[model samples]
Target: MFGDIMGMMGKLKETQQKIEETKKRLDFVLIDEQSSDGLLKVTLTANRTVKSIEIDDSLLDDKEQLEDYLVLVINKAIQKASDVNEAELGAVAKDGMPNIPGMDLFK
Candidate 1:
């Protein structure tokens, strides 16, 4: 019984290490999105943190329209980031929990 407990603890530590490594890899994953009209662009990490934005000069003169475009572009960027995160981290999670039936659905 004691050996079994020790073995499980060792597996738990290995799983924790894998999760941490996946998170670190996710930090380097970036998704870029642009508005349909090419007027705005945004870059974000897989965790949905905005990294940068690029706007066309033509939008500068119209503050209201620019704001709208920025919102649209940012939303697209965030969504893309979410998809990327799900695909990447989801695989890691599935690999870690291989014995759980239908575990892939968790993503």
Candidate 2:
């Protein structure tokens, strides 16, 4: 009983380490998004850190339009980054989890 508990603890620790490593790796995974007309573009890392934004000269003339484009494009980039982050972390966590009697966590 104690042996099983100790093993589970060890597995949990290893899983935590893997999760941290994955997060660090995600910092380099880039996600790019642009407006439908391609006037506004944005880039972000899987860690959801904004990397860059490029706006057309035309957009610069219209403050409201630029703001709307930024909101739309940045949100799309963030959603993509979030998906990647979730998938990577979920896989690591699921793979490292110890199989307990009734816990089908990954299902």
Candidate 3:
């Protein structure tokens, strides 16, 4: 029993170390999340910090309607970036990743 406990402790320590290492890697990694409409793009870091946003040139033709569409695109991109951030964090502690009630993690 004592040996078994020690073995489990060792495993836990290794897992903690691995998680810390993975977190460090996240600082240098960039994750891009995009809108389906493809009119606007937002770049975000793995930590979910928005780095930049870009608007497509085609949007300039219709200034009035373009503003509404741009808003939609920005919202979509932000949502995508949030999802990506959650997914990346989940990847580190994958074993403990939760399953949403009635929702699928694997697409």
lDDT of 2 at 26: 100
Error of 1 at 72 (Å): 0.9
lDDT of 1 by residue, 1-107 (tens): 68776776777677778878877887888888998888888988888888889989999999999999988889878888888887877677666653435545555
Model 1 misplaced regions, further than 4 Å: 1-5, 98-107
The lDDT per prediction is 0.80, 0.97, 0.64
Question: Of the candidates numbered 1 and 3, which has the greater lDDT value?
Answer: 1
Candidate 1 weakest lDDT stretch, 10 residues: 97-106
Write down the TM-score of every candidate.
Answer: 0.80, 0.97, 0.52
lDDT at 74 for candidate 2?
96
Which prediction has more favorable TM-score, 2 or 3? 2
Cand. 2 TM to true fold: 0.97
Q: Give the number of the best model, judged by TM-score.
A: 2
The TM-score measured for candidate 1 stands at 0.80
Total backbone collisions for each predicted model: 0, 0, 0
lDDT assessment of candidate 3: 0.64
Q: What's the distance in Å from true for residue 96, model 1?
A: 1.0
